[model samples]
Target: MALLYNHLRDARIEWNRHQPQGGETEDEAEARAAAYNEKRRLKTVQSSRKSNKLNMRKKVAQKMVKLCFAKKDEEGVAAWTWFLKLLTELGNAGMSSEESEVGDMPTNSGALASVVVFAIRRCPWRLAMVNKYMEQIDEAALVVLTSGHSKHARVRTEQESEKFPPSGLPRAMYNPAWLTVQKTFLPDIEEILNFSEGSFTMMEVEVVIPGVN
Candidate 1:
């Protein structure tokens, strides 16, 4: 994943270097950058298809969640919550009611499932609040985490004959395996949850400004 990220970063830098910069106005520079970024996005999509790499945004989001959870602080919780909401909103966008059914398989469901699994694995203490937020979005986040593997299996079976499947498998499908691995070092979820609870506190304060009250 690091190799893939470095490759994409280098590609973007090369694109920027080749962009016309001779007496260009701010608007022109912005437009050129936007166009270059779109081209880079398409290149990334093609590269991912060819190499079976996960999308950079999703990979980074997952890593960010891991890092935030590792901190186990109030600020980390806030950041994780924000990212979870963003992922859920992104997954829910353009989804149909029927497609959102419990048994129905949606192409974008992986994003939400990934968020749920991360919460389960890293922030189980906040699972209740996570579920409440998911309800606001009309998603059964826990259900998705529990049942996503079967859905992914079905999709894989349906596309068994294809050279490349249309959608990548949900990261949630590997949660069980991850849990098994985690047990070697962190064997007690309850202990982790208790430790997290003791690690962070939220407080409110008033700020005074020099120019304004």
Candidate 2:
């Protein structure tokens, strides 16, 4: 959330700096000012939407974590299955957005990835339990990779391709390697487990552990 705030702040500052200054004709200055304001407005709307989506994901992830600690045996597995279904729903919501056409991939991808990793990390048994959801995971991963939002997509895909070499799934959808790379850059599952309320700010997390990004 802090990262989003900082990004929005930086964007506003950049736009303000680019605002028309002295020596420009009234018409030129007016047009430039209008453009700046419009762009800024659009960016604010985008940021707000992204923030809301992320908050929803965080809430869902927190619930899943709680279930992991609270439930046991068949009951635990059943609860996890339900929560995983919720994640699938969330991911589908993200994918259905028209914004993806404009370079705005689903903000929930990271959250979905995080929750899945958290489950696997905390409970090795979840690996087998989640095997049924592999298709959904692969789909979400494809969205992330093709959206061009992942910094390590190319390199990660290349590495995974050499190992598994892409059979039924796209090379980039290899869940283990994809999750590993996301975990490398994203906030730690332990930190997320500690979250009681409110959003987890990527900037704040990165600050606590310098050089992770």
| Runs off by more than 4 Å, candidate 1 | 1-20, 53-213
lDDT of each: 0.37, 0.37
Q: TM-scores of all models?
A: 0.19, 0.28
Residue pairs of candidate 2 with colliding backbone atoms: 1-201
On residues 8-113, what C-alpha lDDT tens digit does candidate 1 reach at each position?
9999987675566898876788788887778788656544432321222233344445554676555644554554444443232111111111333234655333
Candidate 1 Cα RMSD after full superposition onto the native fold (Å): 19.8
User: Poorest 10 consecutive residues of model 2 by lDDT?
Assistant: 201-210
Give the Cα error of residue 90 in candidate 1, in Å.
34
> Model 2: per-residue lDDT, tens digit, 55-79?
4443443443454455443443454
Worst 10 residues of 1 by lDDT: 154-163
